[model samples]
Target: MMPAKYYLFTDGSVNPQSKVGFGAFLLISDLAISLPEAKKLVETVSFENTSSSKLELQTLLWVLAKLDAVATEVIVYTDSQNIIGLPGRRIRFEKNNYISKNGKQIANAQLYQEFYKLTDRIQCSFVKIKGHKRSLDKDGIDRFFTLVDRASRNALRNS
Candidate 1:
């Protein structure tokens, strides 16, 4: 019998500039090994004029819900450094009024709340990757995020 395949998903986002932005990745081990490589989950997102941390948290919530629906274990990764720094960073949303204490919370609190609710459903880990330190594949993550950010901007303009 073959082991389950794990999933490693990476995601990122951009703010409206001069504001906070976030980027993160997820890893799901103990999955059906016959599934596929872990990289297929990699993706990036973009939100205008939003906090990076919020964006990062939003991405986390999205992935977690998806994972729960599929019943998978995951370990998320991110280059945000700050978000992955402390534990339950997003959980602290209640303290900062759904945003970090230092910045404005995202406009869509309900979305974050819906996703945050899933924290209890699965086991997950948040890891920090040093930026510009050549310590955690920062370049690759940055490039992926940048591409997504630009694409998002273009999409908004077109719409």
Candidate 2:
């Protein structure tokens, strides 16, 4: 039997005018089972006075932290390029002492550090997905993206 593949779709919504944000995630599994038989996980978190980028990165990190050790292979989809770019930028940040071009400490330094630490424990990959649009994939993975997007936005509205 083949191992099950785990897919996580995450999104973050922010209202700059109100300084409110929310992060959401949907987890799906590929198994030879009926739709009802497959477990679906959906969750959201709300925060105030945070940037959308921070919410995005936080959602990704949150999901990673929630993943079980048995989940050997997992893929995470997010609309945030900042979150996707972290792995490549992490090395440079460490070499530069986490300093930015303006000599300020890199933004979200603690979150990025936690994200990196989680990556060391789980064999996972991060993929960038376009937001506020329907997905073109026939496999229906895009549905999860849409789910998280709506959930995050709703959380922002209610928070």
lDDT winner: 2
Please give the RMSD of candidate 1 to the true structure: 6.8
Tens-digit per-residue lDDT, 68-149, candidate 2: 5556667888888897888898789889878889999888888888888888887778888876663454345555577788
Per-candidate alpha-carbon RMSD to the true structure: 6.8, 3.3
Candidate 1 residue lDDT tens string, 1-159? 322333444445454554544444534454342223433443544454566566766666756666676644555556555446444555566677776556877566666566556745665565454433433554544443333344434433443
Off by over 4 Å in 1: 1-11, 18-41, 85-112, 135-159
Instruction: Compute the lDDT of residue 28 as modeled in candidate 2.
Output: 67
lDDT values, one for every candidate: 0.51, 0.76
**Could you say which candidate leads in TM-score?**
2
